[model samples]
Target: MNFLPTDDQLAFRDTAVRFAREKLAGTYLQRARIHTLDRQLVREMGALGLIGPDLPEEFGGMGLDYTTAGLMTEAIAYGDFNISYIQLLASLMGGMVAQHAGRDISMEWIPRVIAGEKIIGLGLTEPRGGSDAAGLQLKAEKTANGWRLNGEKTSMSAADQADAAVIFARTEDSTTGSNGVSAFFVDLTEKGISRTHFDDIGTKPVGRGSVFFDDVVIPSECLMATEGRAFGTIMAGFDFSRALIGLECIAPAQASVDETWAYIQEREAFGAPLAQYQGVTFPLAEAETQLTMMRQLCYYTLNLRDSGNSHTAEAAMCKWYVPKTTCEIIHQCLILHGHYGYTTDLPFHQRYNDVLGLQIGDGTAQIQKLVIAREKVGRVALQYDKQAKGGAA
Candidate 1:
């Protein structure tokens, strides 16, 4: 049965699908090889109001809803996951600033990001600490002028091109955990702020890099969410963004499936079509069924998310299930393609590499399990729930 898409959602999906197929079409391998963010495509997406569909209209966005955001993100991911990552993050970061920080920052930065004139990265991961993001070692100190950020953030996506960034750093009075962390908005072009790109297996178009903050003095306008309150913003991002990660897992798996399905129908063996072989049919059946489950779970999580409830457990379930399933499906599709899947010519090789990041980013599967386990058995949050919502702090 068809799982989602109200009439309006269907229309939204149609618009996104057309954009994906037409504008975002390119060889995934080529995109990665160049490691260049498609500035033109990003601007076109902004012009189409795809960047911040849920952000406030006054802030230069459509301000739709979670469902619409998910629909659009998934559609674009179906074409290019790198594009999905940029648009999803730019819009979400802007909205977060609106919600937790203020309207002024959103009003100014949101439009620039939406227009693809700027990029932003969440600087949580550090050289010393990763999953223990609260245990971050990067230090930020107060100054007469503003703040001085002195530390390094690793595995930062889009850092090289980012006009601005949210750099999480350790504070002097910080307690043992996330409390000790504060967020700073650092301009990449500002003095003492430097970044170097890192080559990786997938998502090469991501401008992923190491950003060193060498006493980078950020002005007051650059401050994103407040210092002590910054950790809250980062944690809050995951609950929603994890659901988006589920969509990320699906895109390449879906692409591989479609590609393999066509190939199987066209290629023949044993004097008959490979489609007639149970060997071919069973794997396809398994991949489709597994992907169906991932899709359903993601849809449910998105619905729960829209209801103002904590879907962290469900998001965890999806973040765990979808990537594993997507990886398996992609591998199976690759096998079904024989050697073509292994070739850079087909793009499956690149897709196979790209799917690995979803499992690692947005809190690893192991970390996600810890989150759910803490929430479920103890009826508690990993961090203290200040709002009494029984959710993440």
Candidate 2:
């Protein structure tokens, strides 16, 4: 894989940095205090073409490769930790709609999503358990007019703020686990729908919450692709999102590291700069080393995707490792700031809180490890219970 970025990728990264500086730098944390982003900020992101990097150009996207999308996400996270999620949702859910939804729906909504005119949330994780994604309980019953959806999707990003969402519901009762589930593009304003936002510790601008669907009606056209076949496609998109999330968390830690570097060079201890002490300098060096490794792994996963290769294991590795490592690095950076980093005056605390949330979202470290193990060992672990029972004397 190429270590150096292409001209187009560099240009996209530059644009992302400029956009973050102008639109997010000072205002993001202030807005997060209120627990939501301004609608106008999202529109501005759309105007700058930062919303959907990997989507086709015909659908108002840059049509760049997924690696370039990762670059944009990484760059933006430097300024605003929560706002990067807009691009994250755009890349994952927006791509799913573009590929699986009907032609008319895709033509109408994908451009709006790409342009940031509308926000869409992915509704997969329920209140029961997020890791066992295939074990969803939301039920969609067939009706005369169309389908009636009755369920609650909890911990959805942009839950209350999103104009619409791609919701998954159980459509069949066959022995198949995930195949019994199907995907739907539902308008959030429809009757019988109620929402409430969460008071999350971090990433508040994205508005995680629960969406209740009580006999919500969905037209047949809204069903994405075929019944009993949507989970595989949606999970594949998660493989892509997992890698992007790695950069999303790492970029902020990286920014903290940069800030700490500058601070140590200027601040003095024992009549010398803090940078002169090995205790101060070595930790930063180690943080930088970890950041560099995670960044390379993120790009490698994205490159695998760009080359049309199966990267589920690599993506899982990224999802599990990056956030955990970034959490440690940022913690070190916080301590390096001595007392100032613990306060709200600086962005360090906010970034730490934000990155901490990622360790639980998308797929948790345990879930990602499970996916990686399954890919490497072919589900033997999954059948360990059966094997253990058989081996019992």
Candidate 3:
């Protein structure tokens, strides 16, 4: 119940904050516009043990708790939202690989991911839909030596740049939905794989794109968890990522608020500083209040995960609410800055666009609400029962 950070947690958070302020803040805008993240900077982060410190030290991490990872993600995002994507993926996708993938695979690739020498992306959403994640279309047929994968995964973050990916494919031809899906760790540089990047409005450095697999073959050892039953097990890791994502979205919005506070104090309006006007100051004050509440909720959710408690409902709440609310806060901060915020010279527009993506990416607000309802009332609250009843009629 106690959310207070121990001394060790505070040390990790302080290190991340110092790194972000000194190394990431100054060139965040410059880096944000780029097509790919700075590999050198990522390696720098890796060297400092900032990537996935929660993973076991045997796998090249510091063996910290999930809350520490969340704090690092939030601190990094405050300086550069795009760079924090690396932290998110490392902890989310990399953890999946470590826990589910074969020990050999985890040892070989995870260390690289933790070291920032490689990136691991998730392959779940297809061209058809993301929310119906279980209804994947990618095919993975068993082969003599391994599995042959043939399909396209779209909307993958860092799709083109990721060194490897944990892909979910439909393994049984006759079965559908979550029943027949299997997960695999595939090297992106495999012979039959091709990649493309999207022209997104924000998070350009963390590019979103499509990864096309054409009869790509991976060894059987790459298969993660129980074959044809990996969907539910592998996906449980998202509860951790959802909470981290809340922190990720909050940081940039907070940065914008901080900048606006300083701006209003200096800019004069009606022969007085803008800060003198209650109209200007009130919005920022309200934003601070919202940010504090959202932050506490996010950390509390992370704590639940760390404590081995059920957090599906809380994680969904963090996933759905924080991103949408923070985007609003950032937009308000942009308006408070007047026309100056609209210009590219300032970070408000970029922060707004970046934070806005999260509202749609992880899971939409509507989907999260459905998850919450299902958690509260079981299957009776889901659409499957209605569909079944209509079919029976």
Candidate number achieving the greatest lDDT relative to the actual structure: 3
Winning model by TM-score: 3
**CA lDDT of 166 in candidate 3?**
93
Q: Write the per-residue lDDT of candidate 2 for residues 182-212, one digit (tens) a residue.
A: 9999999999999999998888888799999
- By TM-score, rank the candidates, best first: 3, 2, 1
Candidate 1, residues 1-393, lDDT tens digits: the string is 245679988887788888888877564456767777878878888777678677777877776767778888888888887888876786567766666654666667877887767777778887777777788878777788778888889888886877777777777563767876777656678899888898888888886789988978876655656666678656676777777778877977887898888898899988999998998988888888887878788877878877787787888888877887798888888888888767877777777778787788767889888878976876455445654766446
lDDT of 1: 0.77
Give one digit per residue, the lDDT tens place, for model 3 in 1-393: 988889999888898899999999889999989999999999999998899989888888888899999999999999999999999999998899989988998899989988999999999999997888898999999999999999999999999999999999999999977999999999999999999999999999998999999999889998999999999999999899999999999999899899899999999988999999999999999999999999999999999989999999999999999999999999998888778788999988888888888888978999889889989988764567668778421
Q: Cα RMSD to native, each candidate? A: 4.1, 1.9, 1.3
Quick one: how many clashes does candidate 1 have? 1
lDDT on C-alpha atoms for all candidate structures: 0.77, 0.88, 0.92
- Poorest 10 consecutive residues by lDDT, candidate 3: 384-393
Give the Å error, residue 306, model 1: 1.2
Q: How much does candidate 2 score in TM-score?
A: 0.97
**Clash tally, candidates in order:** 1, 0, 0
Which 10-residue window in model 2 sums to the lowest lDDT? 384-393
